[model samples]
Each structure stands twice: as C-alpha cells, then as structure tokens.
Target: MKGFIEDTNYSIGLLDDTATPRDVIDNYIYEHTLMGKNAFFVADLGKIVKKHFKWKNIMGRVNPFYTVRCNSSPAVLEILAALSMGFACANKNEMSLVYDLGIPMENAVYTNPCKQASQIKHAAKIGVNLMTCDSETELKKIARNHFNAKLLLHIATEGISGEEDMNMTFGTTLKNCRHLLECAKELSVEVVGVKFHVSSSNNPQTYIHALSDARCVFDMAEELGFKMNILDIGGISENEAQLEELYQAVSPLLDVYFPEGSGTRIIAEPGSFYVSSAFTLAVNVMAKNVIEHDQHLPSAGKQISNKPAFIYCMNEGVYGSFARKLSEKLNTAPEVHKKYKDDEPLFASSLLGPSYDELDVIVEHCLLPELEVGDWVVFENMGCGSLNEQSPFADFEKPSLYNFMSFSDWYEIQDTGNTSESLMKSLCVPCFHLGEDQFCTV
Candidate 1:
C-alpha cells in the first residue's frame, strides 16, 4: 500500500509513510493524464467504520440501516456489509444490489413509500417483506402485490420551515394516520410500525415533534389491533453534534412513548452522516481564461471594485459528480493543491465544468490563486449523492476511484516481524467491478 498500487494499470501510490493528501494527488497526476477525467481520492473504509462505531457509541439503542442511496460504491457497501450494517434500500435495484452482496433480506427495509408495482412484486418474490407506505393508494398497491409485507406508515413531520423543506412530497399526515391504519386492516396489510423523517436540515425539535406524532400513531395502531413494534426515526443530521442534539431531544421521549421492554424496535436510516466526509473529488483544470471587466459586455461600462475574474473549465461539473450542487443545493468551494507566492494576491474566479450547458458551472465566485491548466482543485465531503448521478455526457469517461486506508490491522503486524506473505493473507482490500463504467480500488 505504500508503494505503487499493484493490481491496476494506474501506478499511482503513496510516496512514503508520511505522505500527505496533496502528495497522493500529485503522485496520481504524475502517473496519469487528466486529459478529460476527474478523480476521487476515497478515504478508505476505516473512516466509515469509525463513523459507524461512533454512531453506535452515541446512539447505542438505535439500530442504523445505512442508506444505500447516498453512496452505493460497491467497495463501500462491501465494507459496511463486512461490519454487519443493515441497509435501507429505496428501490428494487438497491435491494438487488444489497442481496447480491449476500446481505439477508431481514436486515433491509424498503424505506420508499412510493414504489413501482414491479418493484413491489420483485421485493415479495425475493422475500423482502419489510416495507413502507404513506397513503391509501400506496397501501392498496402493496396489498395487491404483497399483502403479507410488514409495513411502516410514513408520517409527514413538520419539517424545517424553509424553501428547502421537502415534507409535502412524502409521508402521511397525523390526521390521516387512523384512516391509513383502517385501510391497512381492511386490506389485511400488517402495519408493524411508524416511520417519519424531519428532512435533512431540521432542528432537534423537529425530531422530537416527529417522535411525538409517531407515538400517537403507535398508540392508534395498537388500538386498531395492529402490532406496532417498529419505530423508525428517519435520517436528519449529517454531523455528530446535530445528531447528539437529536438524540438528547428524542431519547427521553422514546422512553415515555415506546419504552424499554415495550417490544418496539428502534431503527434509523442515516445516509450522508456515514460517508460524506470519507471522499474527496479532485478535478483537473483543463483550461483557464482571465476576464477583464472591459473585455466582458456586462461589466464593460461599469467600474468594478474587484480584480479581473478568472474562468476555469474543469472536466467534471454539475452534470457529472457535482450534481449534488444543483440537486441538493450544496455550496462547493475549491481547494487548490498548488502553492502560492507570499506576495501573490488571490483573484475572484468562476469554475465551470466540461459541459456546454450554462448550468454546468460549479462555483460562481470564489477567490483563488491563478492556477495552471494541469493544476488540481480538490473538493472534500464528496461522498454524498455523487458517483451514482455520474453520466457519460460529452463522451467523457467517469473518474477512476482510488480507495486508500489510513489504518489497518496490517500496520500493527508490521512491528511483529510478519512476512509480506502473512500480511497479504491478512489484508483485505475490497475492490470489485460493479459495471463497465464503475471501477473501485480499496
């Protein structure tokens, strides 16, 4: 792992034991041509493992079902599977992917309330009976396709009150909970639990409120003769501080509502919190153009206060791995790997992707040092909702993913005089080809 990566043709590897992240990026750039490609410096599976352990330490009572929709890298999934993490799937393909990894269907929950008929049938055929439904239409669909499926009623919580709120699109309201339970009873669909999401950016109060609503639904379901055994506290925060706040607010309420020995199972579907910081995307600066105010028509006649702007066209953009910027409204800033002079001043720059569409622009205005054509701009926290959104637009090949570990059992054995043979036998690098386009190295 310290020298050249042996298995792949890409000969990039760590320069030394103390190799910095920039050193790894520089080494890769030295080995390969970035002609028209982006790269992902995936922080090894150990980061994910650490995150999982931390989550378990903090929220020990709550079971985490890793959301596969966040980052479905086969290597990521394999590492999580090896650690025995349950999966929260959104569709048939995700279910199949998890099943292909040898994960039992019992450890998975179909969280999507709105599912296709074919997907329902497929889940039933494969014995994945744990699913969710929010409306009568969805419940009817589930009853028709898989009546024996254990169901969770997705209740719409009062999400964050802002333009970014997405509560209206999914989940059943508290007012409709009884009606939904009655419909499930009439259709013979077993309602086993209640699930609710406070959206991505809601405060801890949102979780508390959602939990209170779920408790009401639970009592109602029990009254209706439905065994309410599961309580799904859906995904909310991406950082430990926020999650701790949520736990502090919801833990006590859980005791009051679905208490210990109450025969209720507590689970959560955390996506970005697990893998968001474990990946870094490095985009090559393909071309650059300095734009003076006088050169542009819009600012030609006006007296601009700032310096001349630089436009950098990179290989990947909003249409590619940066789709989260446009889709999830993420604000991405660039980190230049090259060093700058002490006296050199930074200029406002606009970063554009390799696409012809105007919406492909990544960063609108950010002060950066004047960069060369081959320089690299790195973006951290790229593991969320990327990769899977990548497309072959403009005939550009997808970026090659290189996974490197910072900690491993092999490191401890190095001090004990273990031979390379023994190290190779013990080391597990979970690399596999997911498809013709995706290649992962762990």
Candidate 2:
C-alpha cells in the first residue's frame, strides 16, 4: 500500500493496521521529552476525510465552504481542496493560498463583510467575483474596486436569549438590506444572495425567523430585478444529532422558500466541524508552583483542612495555541501524559502560559495529579482556532505539526477516485517517520 503528502518537506506516516493515533502520540511525546520537549500537534488527516463523508451523508444539500481563518495549515487546505470542497477566504493571504492550490476561482467566495480596498482589488485581479457586502460603504467600495463583482448581501440575525450576542453585530438589518440592494442596483453590481450567521446555541425558532427574513429580502430583491440564487448559512453544528435536528428545522423552510425546482444554492461555513477533532496538541510543563491554602468548612464546626493548590505553567498558552480562549470559552481539559494510579490523590491545579502576563492563564481551575517540570500534557479537539495564532509577544514558537493517516484511510481515498496525482503522488513506507527534524519510533 502507498500513501502520500503534498509537501515533500513533510511526509505522511502511513500507519500499519494495528497502529493507532495514540501510539503515534506516545512515540512523539517520548521522543520530544527526551530531546527538547517542545510542544507539538499530531494530526490525523484521515479523520478529515471521514468528516467530509459524514457531511455529505447528513447535510448533502448544503455545500461546505471550508472557512480558512479557522485553521490555515497547508496540509489541511490541500486535503480539503483535494476533496473538491469550496473555500471561504477572509483575506488576501487565504485567497492566495487557495488559488495556489489550483482550486477553481468559482469555488472560492470572499466572505469578509468588511474588506480592505486593496484586497478587494486583489480578488478582482485574481478573477474572484463573488464577495460579501453588508453596507453601502462596502458595496460602493467594491463597485469602485471591482467593476464585475457579484455580491452576497449579509443580513444580521437576532441572538437567542441567554446566548452570546455576537450575532447582533455584522450584517445589515432587513430594512437596511433594501437600501443596500438599491445602492447595488445603482452601482451596476449584481446582488446574488443573502448571508447570515447563526451559532449552535441558537434556538430552532431562530432559523425559522432568519429564513423568513431571507425570503423577505429575496422578494424585495426580485421586485428590484436582482437575481438571488445563493443562501450562505454562516456556521455549522459540531454535533451530528444537533446537525440533524437543525436540518429538520431548516430543510422544510428551504422547501417552502426555495423549492426543489429553485436554482438557489445553499452553502455553509464549516471550519471547526471538519478539523477540530482531527488534531491533538501536546504541551510540556515548563514550571510548577504549589501554594498551601487552608479550606475552611463551616459545616465541620469551623474546621480547616490544609492542602496544596498547584499552579502549573506550560510551554504554550493563550498567547499561542489557546489564543481563541481570549474571546471564546474552552471546556476541553488536558489529560496528564504521565501515568498515575486511579486512586492517586488529585490537587486543585491551574494551568498558565509561559508568559508572565496575568491574562495568559489557560485553565483557571482543574483537578490534576501532581506533576513536575518537563512532564507532558495532551489536549484533544484542538484543531480549530489554534494553529493560526499571530502572537505579538516575543519568543513564541508555534507547535510543530506531525501529519499521518492509517493505511486503510489512504486506500479509502484511493478507492473514491476523488484526488489527483499532484495531491498525493509519492509514498512513504514507514508508519512513524514524518521528516528529518521529527521522526517517531513505535
């Protein structure tokens, strides 16, 4: 059996049938611990393929446009392009990356609601015509930059009660959308679709309202002679059941508004869904501090029990891989790499980054066994919003990435006949060798 990676500098370890991702992680951690103990990521590229197939089976009608801002790893971009997935690029660099991969210009959409003039001109120069606009300023800017631009009018969605109000921002209001469309008509720019973002925490009724609002916008556009054919749903659910529930609520609405005979194309931005579970991160404990604190129990007649509260600092923190924690909540806890008995005593531990800044805290509180400097900690589901951090601080090295796939998965891609020779041309026989810099022994 043969397996390949696009970048010759890195080789995809074609694992034997018996070898699992955990074994790969174990081999890398052991090697890194003995050497420099630098933090790294072990990514299962096969899991991304599985996710693509799952999306096809569950939400086939909605064309998935891989959002580039989520994770811009070259390997991830190449694999997604190989699978014929569309790209949703938010900037010039992302557009260039997708374009360099030989993806068709029609397969990419510039989804940045607020875009710089030079970037818009760059998109135009590259023959990318579909761009999103939410206001007259942006629409007029696009008109001046690109004479032949096809636009997607971004509409705002109402946030659900008790959920984050992030959706309240961005996109023009329903009343404002009419004015934007009118402005588009005047500028000779074609308004092709409507775009709105909804988070998973939103109510099912939220979709009903958003779709109704979109239908209203479509009617308004039709009255003004603009052809509407695309509906860009901005986010996707990570859970399969939740996706199914969402589909149940949305499919009927689409049937009524945009029936089977309608030529409207439905696309979604599924950045985290495809890549989040495929990557695992390993970080080293650079420093540790134990503070003795007295826990007072009023119920126990004011008795005080003295215990040590552990504070640990890791090589990577909010400034690096955990950068998304600055705005979003992180719930995944780190698993101790060193072995400990089930009955071992656990202490209240807090994980911080190597940065001395107080805001660099990674985990505020968690229960962990005592660990010393140089010990490793593994965090899973870290593929999203981690790999593409631009730290302004000094001396931050991004974790190295080790890409691999099982032989079965490699053959599965071969059987599908979906990939080209340029995407996966050569083969590497060994299961654990990645490159000269980092090779794992199993």
Candidate 3:
C-alpha cells in the first residue's frame, strides 16, 4: 500500500547513481524481518539497460531476439520491448506475451524446433511466420499448419572438446540439411535461412566451424532455388567481453562468406546474456535442525564440538526461485544476512525447500554461520530463469519482485532516443518510499 497503486503489477524503486542493488535488498530484508519473513527478489534494471547498450555497441551487426524461456518477468519483457529488441518465443504462451505487448508481428520468431500443431496455427493467425525447424516432421507440420511460414534450417554445430553432448541435441546434421531443404521444397515451404547454436564454451574455432556449416547450408538452399537471407548464429556468449572476442573472431569469416549487399540479415538468440547478472534473490530460513557428528578417538569416542551439521528448510526452493537447482545447473552459494565476525564458527549446511519432496534440495553442501528460524539468505546472479517459478504446494507462493534503477541509468535509457518518459510510465509505477519521482500508470 505504501508503494504503487494496487493495479500496478510491479513498481520501480529509483535509486541515486551511487546506490547499488545491495541497498535495495537490505531495505527489503529489514522490513520483511519485522513484518513477515517472506522470500522476494530485487532486480537492478539498470544492469539490464546497460547490457542492452553493450550488446548494441559490441555486436551491432547481429540483431538479438530475446529468448522468452530464460526469464519472462513482465517488467523485463516491457523494458526490452521498449528498447525495440526482437523476441524469440519458445511456445504459444511466450508468443502470446510478445503479441500482447503490441510489438509488430514481424519482430517475433517462433524458435521452438519441436512445436505443437496448435501453436503453429496460433503463429499463423498472428502473422508471425518466421520460425526455425530441424526435422522433416516439424517442417511438414509447419507446412500443413502454417502455409505462409518462412523457415530457418537449424544446423548442428561441431562441439568443442567437452561440449559434444550440448551440440548433438536439437539441430539437423549437415548431410541432412540438403534432404530437409528438398522436403521443404516439395512441401512448398519457404526455407529462407539457417540457424545454429554453439554451446557456451566461448571458443572462436567452434563459431568458425558453425559459420562454415551455415555457409554450406546456404549453398545447398541456393542449389534448390531458395534465396536465403537470414542467418541466425543461435545463442551468444555470457558477457559482452566474450561477445566482443567472438565478433572479432567471426567478423572476417562473415565478410568472406556473406559480405555486405548480400541481403543476408544476421541475428542471435540471447537469453542469459541479458538477464543473468541483473537480479538477486533473497530467501528466509523457515526451519533449522542441527545434527551432531561423531568422531572416534584413539582412547574414547568423541564428538566434533567445533562444527555441527545443519539442515535448513528455506521458504523458496527448486519448485520456486531455485528451480535450476533441480538439474544441478546453478551451484550458487548463499550469503548469511546477519553481521557476524570473521572468526565466528562455521558449520556444514544443506538447504531444502518447504515441500516434503526429497528432490526439493536447493543447496546440497555449504558452509555458513549459525542461523535461526527467521534469518535471511541472499543469492546473487539469479536473473536467468529464476523469477518465474511458483510453488506447487499450498504452503508457499511466488516470490515478489522489487525492481529498481539508478537515475543515471534512467537518463541513459532516455538518451537512447527510443525509450521515452511515456514508455517508462507504461512499463512500471514508482515507489514513493525510494524517490520523489511519481510514475502514474497510463
């Protein structure tokens, strides 16, 4: 009630240029500790704005299609849409979200290699005919469900030394690209381009091989009388520095293969690259149990008195903000919220969810200070695929999001000339407790 109006889905807390996300998280944790120990999220939207500008400065030639499956927080989508970035939706729900945002249909691509038949019809109905396909079955399904579809032949890249499993998953092989093109021609489906994803190995040689494979696919499409124009270099690197290295490695090849005036438009699907470092998650310890560890001595049995093992039940777990933990993907360590001396005793700890399910473990093993029932724990770099999951059990709900931005970053957004004050008004309300600026809903 002290923040934005009840109708506003999210409110932006304006911080001065010197302030950081830690200040916002600290404020929230202090308030929630007194009221109710609820788990929540604090997003520094300034990092997202900076990331977008960095992408433009570093990889200006390649258009980025924001992958929705990574993190579909409404405020994130609104901010990216305001900046005029295109979208890569994995399914009908994501496509519908983009469509509802009033973005042009041409700016959205259905990138799911295996899609439902009904989702294909929905794409056709919305005039988002640009999509990617890797198999004859999916190609024929699109041909039948959406006649106007223009397809991108997804080619598999040669894996780096340790990324063969990641590279072998979805894309069609080079030998089969010709057969897929033939099948598309027979079905009268337009094969307009090629797409391939190199995993996050950050190797320039891998991208070199992928670009070479893409060029071969383009040649094959040309042999079948298809004028290929789009080249989606699939997902990108984790950060702008790595992206710059990649661009430097591949720019020469791009010019040699498909130079200027070739009419080929380059694009990439980047999800974690945009949102991974922008948000932080804070969870509360709802329950704690201390288990004693026994050690056998030479003369008598003794227990380890210095360190005790603890099992903590957190309000948010794999079913919620830490869903990536289910796959053992995110091994982030949580910081104890209280101020403790460096010499304070550390104990072995394992964190679990509020659910009764045995698989709801969030952190398997870690070292942390002693925490009580209502203490706080914070996880940083949680922006990728973290904010959207909701608990299936009746005991918990989705974590609330508190979005913020520095005034300097806001000014930079205005300087972009694409984002206006009115666009900000449409995206979020203002938290009066944080700043004097008032953003009335439009």
Residue 340 deviation, candidate 2, in Å?
A: 1.2
Residue runs of model 1 more than 4 Å from their true location after superposition: 1-22, 34-38, 159-166, 293-306, 409-442
Cα-based lDDT at residue 34, candidate 2: 79
Select the stronger candidate by TM-score from 1 and 3.
Answer: 3
Model 2: runs farther than 4 Å from truth? 1-9, 160-168, 295-306, 390-396, 420-422, 425-429, 433-442
Better of 1 and 2 by TM-score: 2
Show the lowest summed lDDT stretch of 10 residues, model 3.
294-303
For all candidates in order, the CA lDDT equals 0.74, 0.82, 0.81
lDDT of 1: 0.74
**Model 2: per-residue Cα lDDT over 304-390, one tens digit each:** 245677889899989888998899888478899989999997777789988868999888777788999999999999999987764
lDDT of 3 by residue, 1-442 (tens): 1322112355566775444566678787877777687788878888888899889888868899999888887668877887788999999989988887778988888999899999999999988999999999999899999999999999888866655454668899998999999999899999999998887776899899889989999999999999999999988876678899999999999998878679999999999889988888899999998886333121133334666678899999888788888774673678988899999877777889998479988877767888999899999889887776878877676677777787787777677666634356743544323332232232
The TM-score that candidate 2 achieves is 0.90
Which candidate has the highest TM-score of all? 2
Worst 10 residues of 2 by lDDT: 295-304
Q: Distance (Å) between predicted and true CA of 334, model 3? A: 0.6
TM per candidate: 0.84, 0.90, 0.89
Please give the RMSD to the true structure for each candidate, in Å. Answer: 6.5, 4.2, 4.4
